[model samples]
Target: MLNQIEAFQPLNGASRERYVEDLIFRFEANDTTSTEKKRAILMILCGPYAYVMIRSLLTYRPLNEVTFKEIASKIKEHLNPAT
Candidate 1:
């Protein structure tokens, strides 16, 4: 699947909101299965710099300590202050 794409870079804050929407649209359009969806979502959440930031938030605890669900929840809360 990846070979067909020209390039896929990790997203940052500048247009991350739009990036997320686009990712969702692509995933849904492809009819991704639950497991594949979870894998793709994890890749987004665990970008190259994410572990360091998540660790700082957790005071340097082992990354295994935080489940992906917890990470996603924290991210959602951070992104949607009004919620």
Candidate 2:
């Protein structure tokens, strides 16, 4: 799992550490049966870094122009890209 994250690299130090910690905690818990719940947990765990990244992406855009579906799609693409 670390390998999966390391592939992305260049993350801010504090953010990266928090991400790693959260990843481990989630992996260990492994209790969620719903994909949506699991994904939400992961995103919440990402915290400020994920918040900042998504906010920047939606900058100058109205709330109606932004959607969790779009954010989820981007997250899925980034975290589980096809090789």
Candidate 3:
């Protein structure tokens, strides 16, 4: 998962929105269970944000603490506001 993130271009603004959408679609198409999808979405985040999330994950644990789905939804809200 980390390798996949490394291979993709880092994004901001509109591109980030598209990237997140694509990731969600991919996860859905893969028939990944909800839990796996959430974790994968969180792992896909790059840069300083990713570091912060990782630190939190380590401290709180991925499954029992904050979920990847919640994080992804927050990101979508911030990055893809309605016109």
Candidate 4:
């Protein structure tokens, strides 16, 4: 997963790190509406290189103690209910 994420990258380390931090913080807060969470997740998943760094960090370490796969699966399920 990390390798798959890294393949899309050319991101600067600091910015990438910040994005990871922000993602973790948001996930932890759990204050956003389901719609908002789905939107953000969709934005990340839909983009090409834009979300690569964040995805790499997620695959590398669990955010807010939640597995990236779990969050991603949920988001995907939300987007595609029939799946």
Candidate 5:
């Protein structure tokens, strides 16, 4: 299934919105509704930096207890910080 879908590229030089949109498209294409599955896919495909950032962002919360939306929101807030 990963081979069929376009590979997730590194965040370098890419817009965060584009990166997130691509992830959502893949999730929809696979009919993924489970939060756990979404979080797994996101962490696995989002590269090491993002994985670490997510962990740091949710330091107080157990990773298993974190929601996909929370991870996504943190990524957005980090990548698109206001001036």
Candidate 6:
């Protein structure tokens, strides 16, 4: 199933929202309901650029203490282009 989901490409002109949607789809496909596992999987598969971004965004607290929603929101917010 790992083969089905590609690593997120935040630094490659990819649509962050679309990639997030795809990731959620993959999660649903695999019946992955645990937010802890979701966060872990996201950290593993979100690529190096995103890992750095997430780390910076979450510096106020330990990564393991964050919820998936917080991580998702932070990633989405951080990757959005300035208008």
Taken over the whole model, the C-alpha lDDT of each candidate is 0.50, 0.51, 0.56, 0.46, 0.75, 0.81
Estimate TM-scores for all models: 0.43, 0.35, 0.52, 0.32, 0.79, 0.82
Clashes of each: 0, 0, 0, 0, 0, 0
Top model by lDDT, which number? 6
Candidates 2 and 3, the one with greater TM-score? 3
Question: Model 6 over residues 1-83: C-alpha lDDT tens digits?
Answer: 74466666765666666777778888888999999999899888877877888899999799999988898888778777467
lDDT of 3: 0.56
Could you arrange the candidates by lDDT from highest to lowest? 6, 5, 3, 2, 1, 4
| TM-score, candidate number 1 | 0.43
Kindly provide the TM-score of model 5 when superposed on the true structure, using C-alpha atoms: 0.79
Model 1 lDDT, residue 54, Cα: 50
Q: For model 6, where is the 10-residue window of minimal lDDT?
A: 2-11
Ranking by TM-score: 6, 5, 3, 1, 2, 4
lDDT of 2 by residue, 1-83 (tens): 42243322325555444554555455556654555554455555455657666556557875345544565555545545689
Query: In model 4, where do residues sit more than 4 Å from their true spots?
Result: 1-9, 32-46, 50-66, 69-83
Model 6: clashing residue pairs?
A: none
- Backbone clash pairs in model 1 (N, Cα, C under 3 Å; residues 3+ apart or in different chains), count: 0
Stronger candidate by TM-score (1 vs 3): 3
**Alpha-carbon RMSD, candidate 3:** 4.9
Model 4: weakest 10-residue lDDT segment is 1-10
**1 versus 4: better lDDT goes to:** 1
Candidate 2 vs candidate 5: which has greater lDDT? 5
For model 3 the TM-score comes to 0.52
Candidate 2, superposed: residue stretches over 4 Å from native: 1-46, 56-64
Candidate 6 C-alpha error for residue 22, in Å: 0.9
Q: lDDT by residue for model 1 over 1-83, one digit each (tens)? A: 32122222335554444434454455566675565454456555455555454556667555455655565555555555673
